[model samples]
Target: MKKTLLGLALSCVAGAALANDHDDRWMLSTNLIFNALDNNKNLESDFGLGLGLGKFLNENWTLDFEIDHVNVSQEGGGGSVDQIGLGLMTRYHFSPDSSLRPFLGLGAGYLDHNGSNNAQAVDSSDFMLNLSAGLRKEVTDRVSFLTEVKYRLDTDDYTGTASSYDDYLFSMGMSIALGAAQAAPAAAPIVEPAPQLDSDGDGVSDQSDRCPNTPAGMAVDMYGCHQVDGDDDNDGVKNSMDRCPDSRPGAVVDADGCEVQVVIELQGVYFDLDKATLKPESISILDAAVKTMGEHGTLVVEVAGHTDSSASESYNQALSERRAKVVYNYLVEKGVSADRMTWKGYGELSPIATNDTAEGRAKNRRTELVIQD
Candidate 1:
């Protein structure tokens, strides 16, 4: 029953050790023990003490060396004897959680035994080995109470004795964690913003300002100088710079800042009802659009969403806008630059197809990706 209990305790400790996240470099510990041994039909009991110094390789494992002093008395023996020995030990933690730790150690050393009658029996310094298992219960951030049981084997050449002796020791100890050891933090790479370039004496820098060529002395925002009431196409570019000012209201534009292409038709496309989530089948269409944009790096794209006539105009407008924004966000999340895209929604007001038919309404509930070169 005792052996079974010990086994259960060890298993629990091992599990705990596996769960603790320890990032430390060194550890030192000491133990006070009560030892007992059985030889043939006789039982011997003793009081023992040991001290250890250890270095931690990581949070999970440590290497240590220890020395012990013990005093033992046997039944029917005339006197008590004392012995001292030294050995090496090691421990391993199995996991990343901090509550419990299980460890194991092995050691070998020479023992010198001295009896009270001034008779010192120095058998050619014999060897000893220990097998131990224990758990450490953390009481606080830096300290823990440990309990362990060890089976020790001692070699002897008592002239008439045929075999060696074995002993069992149960120990309870408190461990103070030495704080010098810790894991290094991971490093992050540094990023520098792109440099700006400006031509044409327009106070706006080329990197951000969409309108690079501005007239010599007009008022301008960060981009460049332009007239306030002169946007013929209402495309945000003023008449002074809008080359195709009378072009259709929603035609896409080119770099001389002129309307150049009209959106004639959209290929097969479907969006979730009142939502922006792209279905699996729609992914290939979006991917193709991205590929098109990649081939023309200087061409910025505007993704606009439109909805059918069934919904309230205001709600449909907002939903349509969200659908367009979702596509834009997905592109950026997939590594497209935010500066290269624009998004808007027209709801039922800008439907390209008649609202009365199912096929026409399906076409109205669509997203259009327009390239502005």
Candidate 2:
């Protein structure tokens, strides 16, 4: 029964790592214990003590290393037993952030036991496996009280017998959280407002204003210039200097007023199940997108992320947005100009495939790159 619980606790540890979000990282704990050691035909129970240190891989899961020591004396005197152990355990908490949390754990360790001055000297040194269940109650932000019950199996020949030694331990203690290890906040976006018409209040719009920054109340021409200048296309370039006189309105232009072409697209970037994290295999495809953008340095593109209809609408929307931001950040780190990129999430609202099937859902969960020039 104890072995089965240990196996389940190990499974919970993996599941918790991928799902939990809270991030308080390290813990130190101590416990006073009651131990019952059974080695058929002889039973002894006594007081023990333990010390442990734990690290949270995620909010709901922790890995702990512990040392335990116990001493038991025979009722009739002239005999005593001593045991000490060191072990490693993994635990899964049911409610990590609550005032009260329940947890289950599994551990394996080495134990050294010695019996002194007894009619039948019992001595053994071996490895032990244990399963435990516990409850913790918060006393403050950095402190908590803990109580637990554990069953350990000692795999050793006790008095030359074949059966394994089964030990039960009951303990209560306190835990202290260490350091400030919460996850950092997400990055805030940088926003630049669009340039406005008549920004200087000189009675001219920026598109046609040759001297757009002319001092306030200055007298100006149709060109919004302090001096007379002919610019037929109203593209800020004097007509004599205009290389592309018929430039399209709102088109990005060089000093000669010629429009620039900058466009690129990416398709098929994928993510893990219900997560914003990019899958390893999707890196090559995204790198291709990066290469294409690098070849066209001035390209402005939108990176849109989408998800299948599996989770709640709000959750999918937020998750998709994070996924898009992850790709956008990746590109920025790889030398793509941040000013040329924008990102958004479409969530499950714009699925390209049927969400009812696994294959279709996979097809629907993808990111797309669209040229905006």
Report, for every candidate in turn, its global Cα lDDT versus the true structure.
0.65, 0.75
What is the TM-score (0 to 1) of candidate 2?
Answer: 0.49
Q: List the residue pairs that clash in candidate 2.
A: none
List clash counts for every candidate, in order. 11, 0
- In model 1, which regions exceed 4 Å deviation? 1-25, 40-43, 116-124, 158-160, 179-373
lDDT of 2 by residue, 198-291 (tens): 7778887887676768888778766676765587777677775579999765466777778765433345576664568887888888888889
lDDT of 1 by residue, 47-106 (tens): 788787665443455556677788776457745666676766556654424567787765
How well does each candidate superpose onto the true structure, as a TM-score?
A: 0.42, 0.49
Residue 154 lDDT in candidate 2 = 78
Which candidate leads the pack in lDDT? 2
Q: How far is 278's C-alpha from truth in model 1 (Å)?
A: 32
